[model samples]
Target: MSFSIGIVGLPNVGKSTLFKALTKIKVDIAAYPFTTIHPNVGVVRVPDERLDKIAQIFKPEKITPTIIEFIDLAGLVKGAHKGEGLGNQFLAQIRNCDAILEIIRSFENPDVENVTGKIDPKNDIETIKVELELKDLEIEERNLSSPTKLLQSKSEGKEEKENLLSKKPIIYLLNTDGKTQYQVPKIKHLIMNLKDELEILELSDLEKKELGVKSKLDQLILACYNILDLITFFTVVGQKETRAWTLKNGQTAPEAGGVVHSDFQEKFIRAEVISWQKLVETGNWKKARELGQLKTVGKDYIVRDGDIIEFKI
Candidate 1:
């Protein structure tokens, strides 16, 4: 239930500064390139508004959100594919990541040294992409060069099956976009439905009203939500704060209970679930359950984003 991303770039390309900004922890940052010889690691909470709403209803002793593990590894030089310039060590660390965040320094500054000896975002991006592609291609080429030798052994088959996890994706975190580019897995049922042949209209009055809630780093919460592939469910009561809990898309009730604790999942029980769209349309969870919009689903049900679930453990 855990995933990770590797932050990569050339030397002195603000990887450490970006890492500090992300985790809010201090790390070594020097004017000189290669200041960080060892990788810096940080785990960031996946913020979810649903956890608060869920708390509002259940008043749980604790609330937990999913997390993303990030690794700020050493810079990739031109000859990294050939194990040059701390290449083998860095590549080894990153090869295990579920995804990659390539940070390109779009801004220009002569004071800081550029490992490639210049500053250009597009060129820098290409350099990193090419190196990764080269790394992949090298594997592919070797697989082809000695297919009989590598694959003929039975043990090699098991290794190849497990090695599928090593197929990491390269996500470009554009300079202007901040971190949104790599935040979400662009695959979900509801969003897919909404965005299918999507169109944009001018901002509405309601949207303008909602904008006030975002005070700093407006998209940060949304980014965390995406990273977790989470769905939000809310609970509200009179004289109580509306609470939200995070559940993964397509997660079952028992699986979600596991998010809270192993004890809950172990105890075993049914779930009181209501669709958020129904609540908004009907104006109450009681009415939602009455209208058959609320559902009692087993652990096998695939949780959707914006679902309102209350486990009946």
Candidate 2:
């Protein structure tokens, strides 16, 4: 299973442009509002140095990295929660996402139209937040006989696990032009010239290096992982393959095994675990075992990031 993040914003905020840059797959991009009615889905592999190191050491025939799926939805306008501008349909597309990336326009282009007719990131953020909160409250009211007080109170809590759009962890992305200067707050934010960078992506590796351009794509993916509170683990299949997997922050070994396969979860007996760092330091698993760096853990073991696990059924 892959972690998913939904990209949201007001019209002409470069949401689809950023999506194209990230995925290298172009979707319809225009100056008009509501250009993207249906969500555009793209899968991106999670970059890990540990996976490269493991591949280098083992010379595995195949290596599979974990991935994140990005969903780009249509823009939101005022009264979105009340079914304005296809707001309800767009919001519905993002309901199952693991996190949200709210793109705010920090650049000015008279050619492109902003639905709000201004480039105030703060106001744009509040507009999206208020609409999502209203939508969540509406959903709760329709689905439950509980009082509004309980829903409101639960919504105020730090960790929102109830699939509420407003309550989900959010990372603000400032869609900027190359020369535009914008003040960013203390919250999570990323500044990018999506169209320009997307053109850079078309260049060859040698050309990119000649231009001294190091892409921030991997950094963006890692940021998404952080907001979702995800951890990566590894499993090697004999001498043929090595693969990376993701688990939630406090998930158990059995639950993690379920991510690999259903039968692995049901038949799990125990796991041989070791940190990828320790394994690298020891040169091999046999040496790590001899050095007592390898551990035998049961179903109750909480998997840590960078753990290399061998499940015994």
Q: What are the Cα lDDT values of the candidates? A: 0.62, 0.85
Query: In angstroms, how far off is 153's CA in candidate 1?
Result: 10
lDDT of 2 at 15: 88
Best by TM-score: 2
Residue-level lDDT of model 2, residues 1-313, one tens digit each, is: 7889999988889889888988878799998888988999999888999988877778889999999999988999888889999878988887888899889998888888877877787788888889998998887776466656566757777233467888788998887876665566566688776777787888899998898876777888899988999999999886799999999989888888889998989999999999898888777867788888889999999999999998888
TM-score of each: 0.67, 0.91
Q: Residues 171-288, candidate 1: write the lDDT tens digits.
A: 5543332322322323221111111111112235576456632222214435534654556555444334444556667767787777656786877587777766566667656667
What is the clash count for each candidate, in the order shown?
A: 10, 0
Best candidate, lDDT:
2
Q: In model 1, which runs have C-alpha deviations exceeding 4 angstroms?
A: 58-61, 144-167, 176-270, 276-293, 308-313
Residue 224 C-alpha lDDT in model 2: 93
